[model samples]
Target: MTLDALRLEVPDILQEDAASLADLNEQLAEARLQPQEHALQQVLSLLFRLNRSAMTLLERQRALQSFSEEYRHYAAAYCAGVAPPILFVRFCAEIATGFKRLLLQILQGRQPSRPHLAWCLYMAQHFLAQSLLRHYQLYQEPPASLWRDSHLLYWLGEHQECLDEPVAAAFQPQPANTLRGLYQQMLLLALSNPFHLAEGESPLLFSALAPLASLARLLPWDVDDDAEGQTVDLTESQPCLAYDQAPEGDSHYLRRFELGALLVALHEPAPLQSALERQLLERVRHHWLGRQQRRHARSDHAGDCSLVVGLTAIHAQLLEHRPGHCAAQMLDTSPGGARLLCHADQGRLLPVGQLVLLLSSSATPTLALVRWRHLNVEGLHLGLRYLKGLPRPVWLRRAPSAQTHPGVLQSTPVQGGGWHHGLWLPNEQFVEEENLWLQLPNVHNQAALPLPAPNLATPLVARHPLKLA
Candidate 1:
């Protein structure tokens, strides 16, 4: 029963500068980018593990510093027009990896610690993404390979833990559907559900489309529009519109149910790349550079909001579907109660209302509620909660029925979007330090501060890359 409600006080946090970010945005966009191929790729996988490894303070600091500096040099070179296209892609990937590393530090730290450094890493990640979209044109062909790693799927939940500090405890018992289900559904969606598409050849392509259908259905709509958790004129009901300017002049109504964020934070970035790239890029710049310039742009206040995204893992666990379960493990259900799955690949059975922590960390060991929804030939649906929306600004998805059961272990990949609004705590709530979070409000939480703004230009002064040899 670790899925207890966590209360996060919406802090009147320092906002990332929008204009300065735009400047860096331009630099990152124009830089040529290329995908990682050799040593760098293997190293990236290693770094993610090193992120949570037991290392000395100096070792940890140096690791983060070196990682960040690499991106800076990449950026500096991009500005000088020397980096390659694939390098640009590597740069973005590295930066994202770097941010993920920093974010882990923040989560692993004691609660109530200065988070300025963590915030800076957050901003850097933002800027790096700016460069990513500017150069890649993600949607044309998303760097699918970038997020193929299941373990590194999307450390979105970490970001959620930071943003929704207080209200992070577990919520209504429900299973976290996770990207595995989405991908599985995507793989089989077209074949099983014809209404979603006409005909498709690519299996993964169909798997990719399933989530949009899921998002379309998650909207807080009045009409059933055919509630079987499927079938809806998604674009018609909520009608994709910018945050600041509402489509029908009811912009205020648009903010309800934390809609803008969930899609941006938890869903795929490729789909929204075309539409939200600009805003997202702007936000990234602000996070890293803390600068903004005003220019008349079209609708869609894309940037300038917080975000959380959930991506599928390139490597996934094998779950077999059968009886209660093909094997004998746990099950998970979608928010809409349509899909179900288990932790083990060989599909298994569930005892009952089983509550378990999704992402258990040495720092912030948080749990999620799970339940057995259905056992079709596809998979088991474990009702989930906690992931809908963190802290506050809960999503309008139907809450799982109040139920409880034994416990187990599991993890889900996720990412969040939207920083513009939520249950924000006024400035009075925090004890500040160059804009970071600290535990006890008055104590020093060393882990919260970022190692430093990385300057990749600082040659690998040490022989061992991450350490001062």
Candidate 2:
């Protein structure tokens, strides 16, 4: 589709010599004072207007890069804490719009050189990847338009590249310019269980995968190829279309990716920074290879449950004896997890990877993690994984003079059905192996050692094994 055919409207901000870095900086300064959602909207609009203005190809590149860097800051802030659902959706839409604009420019032969075109393509891919990451973060299905745009861009890239031609982007540590390379990155992100990722973890995971993304092989979807574990429909924007989801017709547009080479690279020894990073890479590998076997079978369930979200709210409800803040209807239940449906308004308050306390008439209060979430006209659907043990709210402090913090002490089930004591404290509040005083109900302060526990899918809290000191 041509730019004129798309009929994108030009913003009124267009003017002679208006799309300069100085003008962008001034507007960005003003945007900082506004609310985060509004500020992001305004900045994105300003960037789009600048890109559409009369400027050299080089100038447009600089403008796009600046917008990207600035937007990264805003995205980090959003990832660090709870963001409004409207803002999150808008963020994805704006990223797509910006990417679409760039793709149109490249398709119209606005690129002056092959190298410059490659850079533009990289920027476009970056924008698309950002949108995809945000969607996966919330476990929301991407709209059809996103896949349509992606197909268009991939077709363009396939025609432009020569055999084994290396395409590199400015400031990118690894080259990912080929159609398969770029597309594989998207596939890896999709396979990554982003719903369980902690705050700011998505970006780190992506960076780690950049060097290995090209190792994955993408081929035309064929039902006979068992090697190709995951399938993606270029015409639809749903989750990975596994073998069962493949349709009878339109198999040509379906693409399946194999993770054999990528898994090999992951298995090799590398300079991974932390245990967390290693764990994340291992998880991504498992997902790409379709090795995530369900331990429990889900059964249909019907009931209503009340819940309190976040560490502070759950602490207050359990310790202070306050009522749950929201109600949800149980959809399904498994030994490991359960699904619930709640009002969209209440669901927006519970982000993925958050801690929650679920209460029902039929069952005792259960500690669970918000594993996945989806919103629709009816309400919000949440997938919740139960924690290992029941929790008791308690107050904790590092020293007698230090202010107290809310925490949860639980008897977590260990291997062989034995139970081990652990503490769930607000994120960053506990230091490994450090001594802390735990205040229990109607009891004196007890000394305990805060040792690291297995990483649970709780972004707002840290889990630590407790040892009597």
- Cα lDDT tens digits for candidate 1, 237-264: 2112322332343322221222233235
Report how far residue 416 has shifted in candidate 1, in Å. 59
For all candidates in order, the CA lDDT equals 0.29, 0.67
| Candidate number with greatest TM-score | 2
Global fold similarity of model 2 (TM-score): 0.76
Per-residue CA lDDT of model 2 for 1-469, tens digit only, reads 2212143322332556745666766777788789877887888677656655666545655666666666666765654433335564555456545545554555576444665555555566556666666665555666655555655556455556621245554332232555456656777776776655655566667667777788876677777776747776655555466645545447766667777777878878777445766777886666675556778999999998888888888888887669557889999999999999998888557777788899899988898888877765668888898987878888887876589888887776668866787777777766666767778777775655455654552666777766543
Give the Cα-based TM-score of candidate 1 against the true structure: 0.25
- Each candidate: RMSD to true structure? 29.0, 5.2
**In angstroms, how far off is 144's CA in candidate 2?**
2.4
Instruction: List TM-score per model, in order.
Output: 0.25, 0.76
